[model samples]
Target chain A: MKSVYIVDDSIISPLGFSVEENLQNLKNNTTGIVEVKDTSIHTDSFYGGLIDEKRLTDAWDALSEIASYTKLEKMMLLAMQRLLDKNPQLDITRCGVLISTTKGNIDQLKENNTDRAYLDTLASAIQQFYKLGNSPTIISNACISGGLAIAIAKRMIQAGHYEDVIVVGGDLLSEFTLSGFFSFQAVSPKPCKPFSKNRTGISLGEAAAATWISGSIKNTNISEVVEVVGEASANDANHISGPSRTGEGLYLSIQRALDEAKVSASDIDYISAHGTATPFNDEMESIAFSRSGLEDIPVNSLKGYYGHTLGASALLETIIAKHHLLANEVVCSLGFDELGVSYPIDVIKKNKAIAMQHVLKTASGFGGCNVALVLKKVSI
Target chain B: MMVEDYKITSFCSIKDNKVIVDNKVLYVHEEQGTVKEFTKAIYKSLGIKYPKFYKMDTLCKLGFLATEALLRNAEKPDNQTALVLSNRSSSLATDRIHQESIANKEDYFPSPAVFVYTLPNIVLGEISIRHQFKGENAFFVSEQFDAKLLTDYSRLLLDTNKASNVICGWVNLDSNKYDVFLAIISRKGNTILTEEQLNKLYHT
Candidate 1:
């Protein structure tokens, strides 16, 4: 019956490396998705949310001379470092670490003769580097992993074992994923337009986001304090990769979240959707929102701003939503100009000022996994 | 931390387009594939249904079966439940297969069919659909079995009231074999089980 509040958040995406940079771009509606000229891909035009490898060198100093660490590690370390800087009094040992990622050094896997050694090596290296050997845990539940990571951390803190939880979610785009999304016919040739009549597919992206959650109030400097009140998950037994036409899983998850939070569907002020821009994903989410009685709520997807960051999507989007909540402004759904789906809803097209006391972040993924987390602005 | 009650509902596995279970062997007559096929066969048997599961790779199939079993036993909770899951390699196996399809000259074609299984939490998606038990869901990867972590995570969910019921477990699948187990623990005092009790149930 305790509450978990967001103490701090950090994001490193194509929009820019630091949280401030991404926020500035988001506020200005400057998208990071762009056409790729790489020859490895079959498509001549592809948009992706890419990170600056050159900017990551600054994070190398935090590394403990560990040879096994990869670029993704440094990205996560940098984001977390920034988060700690914002809230220096956080007790790392007392906080549970929840990590959300889809592919961990999978590019290494693609290289012939590589065993599963990368996992142990990376985990150990991270633990040693952060001195978080006992507290770290990783979540790899496909796209919903980020949202789920926050849910897990909230769970542990509520259980009384940990007072603070550090949730980190990130993934790097490699040939491993580009080929897979390409194979599924799910990759958008151009920058993705969520809920557009001509919406193509999800543009791949790579980024890292870290957040601090706890019940105790530590930082007074934070402008807006948001509390994650309810969380839920469900399985869509319908298909492996495709979602159920009814969106039964998403509906169940949201309903459960509302019930636990002791709130009604009408109470939600806004919805930070998992509009991946894929044909089926956008349509299904619209339908789910409608069926859940969220038709009137303002909806938007951050995909245009950061591409589909995969593992980092939920957390990154959550961080964006946090910033918006603090700023008292909701960024418009960047690439959406029309209500492409049959479902009746209002998709914001421009940055709008609104008094949002509660917002719901929703995401669904391949195995028919659906997750929804409800956040309330705390009146500290 | 108590499981008032739980059940395994629908379970099925698909290998070579045929479904197999504890008693049925669908591939006994087939010539052979490889160790991959054998591993797929094990995953196929672990499921509760065949036709629907045929499309999924190992990770999705294992998650679907385990989550289906979980919902079948426990009634749809009155409130939202939390999902805390763990796997060893995530979707690396499917990623490897997908990567091979494109990188190899002989098999330069990419199948959207095969590419869809690369997401680790696809099983959670599948479970969300079947049970409509949406609360909080998360999947984690560990070097080895660690039930303490699972219990600790579940306790967090319960204590925060972020989830009144937490369905937590482990489901791992790769080229060699697969193992799956899940439980829905409640924050309510009734029908609770401690970490030690849950560990015994899974390990023993």
Candidate 2:
């Protein structure tokens, strides 16, 4: 199989608009999550991480000339443009475009903007505006969509369909999603605490982040090469809203990814888990990791830093994981006061520096979907 | 490049309130009713007792019924079978229902059952659970039924050993409109599934 490397990336979140800023905030132990009383999305108070609108608009206006796009559109476009600006040598017209989201423009439903609620509209608009290589393909398998997008891009590249792919993942917090989670009683009132003894549920957040994955380094001058080695997606075959009692799906995903990456469980230096902080999610992940012989690896969930961003959470966490690999450090799994889950697995508690090579990223979502991707930091 | 060994083992189509398997019509609705009623009527013809059928959204109901007809006679498939299904409108049909539940002023309450089916891929989960097949699955939202995309991706899964078998095709559903086509793919089968074959099966 041909190699696929993470060439360029950008993250737009409440923590910051740039990768450097987001990384600085992570280093400083600053969280984007906070108590939000936005009755527009929910009637009662809820905790979430929301992007500052004024700053977002200001940043977009300074760089982009088009103002017809919605706020989410601007966020995704800006995220992609930042990467495009940094790598002018890359060709937008030749790279595949993959957008991952559970609900795109879903906010339009509440505002009577049904025309924009179609995910195809958002994808086509982005494709036309950027003149992407091909019509964009959307992965909408709940929260695992983002990780599956990267895996799909890698597969397309390996199939020799495209040399590069731009994967942008984003979702907005709205009444539709908020009410759905509320009905399920899955939203936390306070900041989300993944793997904590008192962990309640998820804290819904929103952000748009993009990563430029290339099959080779011939097009641009990128030095830090984090190659996407192995990836697998599986269904729990258990429940739609609940996780499997045995964590079978996630365990299979990890095992398959490890086999594809040609590495054993212990070879994985660090793990960036999909700890949604929900009782079922964290417990399922622990069982999955422990069953896969990943019990002792330092695992951290970025949920506390940025509330579960839905489809963007996996890619956003992956971007941060890349930063961890480059710096050879592990970020603290915030909101985790004590270990609370079935089975036993090492959960990183604080920011610590350590030499890292290969890292594992895993995510599970509604519809019994689970995805695992192994990223290797290699010196060229 | 297609997987040389793979072929379409079986396929079924459920649309126009008719359940057709391998060009044979198994059931057809007679009365004028909503898609939900049509689904219920057709599922009754199967004579199977899976009570969970009634709770699925229209999209999943159609998909489950189609898969049931296609696999009724076949042996149990391996757990590593991958599901690569696509659609045009995605879960817009149920999205509208779920959206309405939350958008109403007087009855403004979300139903977890309806909310769970708001995403298109929940059908994949439902199918996996009913069959106990845990494997790689994805819900792709395309502009339309792209047979070439389905053919190439399905072939890749078999060739790369990502899945021993694959259940792939387009399953689109919206209000008063739906086109569901599911095919069982594997390395040992009678008929090879090319782009042209997929197109033919879609319109079959």
TM-score of each: 0.85, 0.97
What local lDDT score does residue A231 receive in model 1, on the 0 to 100 scale? 82
User: Tens digits of per-residue lDDT for model 1 on B50-133?
Assistant: 465667676766666555534444456643655667767676667777877878655688788777777666666556555554
- The TM-scores, chain A only, for the candidates as listed are 0.95, 0.98
Per-prediction interface RMSD in Å: 3.2, 1.2
lDDT of all predictions, in order shown?
0.73, 0.88
Write down the C-alpha DockQ for each prediction: 0.47, 0.79
Segments in model 1 whose C-alpha atoms lie over 4 Å from true places? A40-45, A58-68, A113-121, B1-49, B59-85, B124-137, B153-169, B177-192, B197-204
Q: For model 1, report the TM-score of its A chain.
A: 0.95
Model 2 chain B scores worst on lDDT over the 10 consecutive residues at B1-10
Per-residue lDDT over A169-238 for candidate 2, one digit per residue giving the tens place of the 0 to 100 score: 9988777888888888888889999999999998988999999998897766656689999999989999
Predicted candidate 2 versus true structure: per-residue lDDT over B8-114, tens digit per residue: 98889888878888788999888988888888887889887899998899899888888888888887788888999999888889989888887766788689988
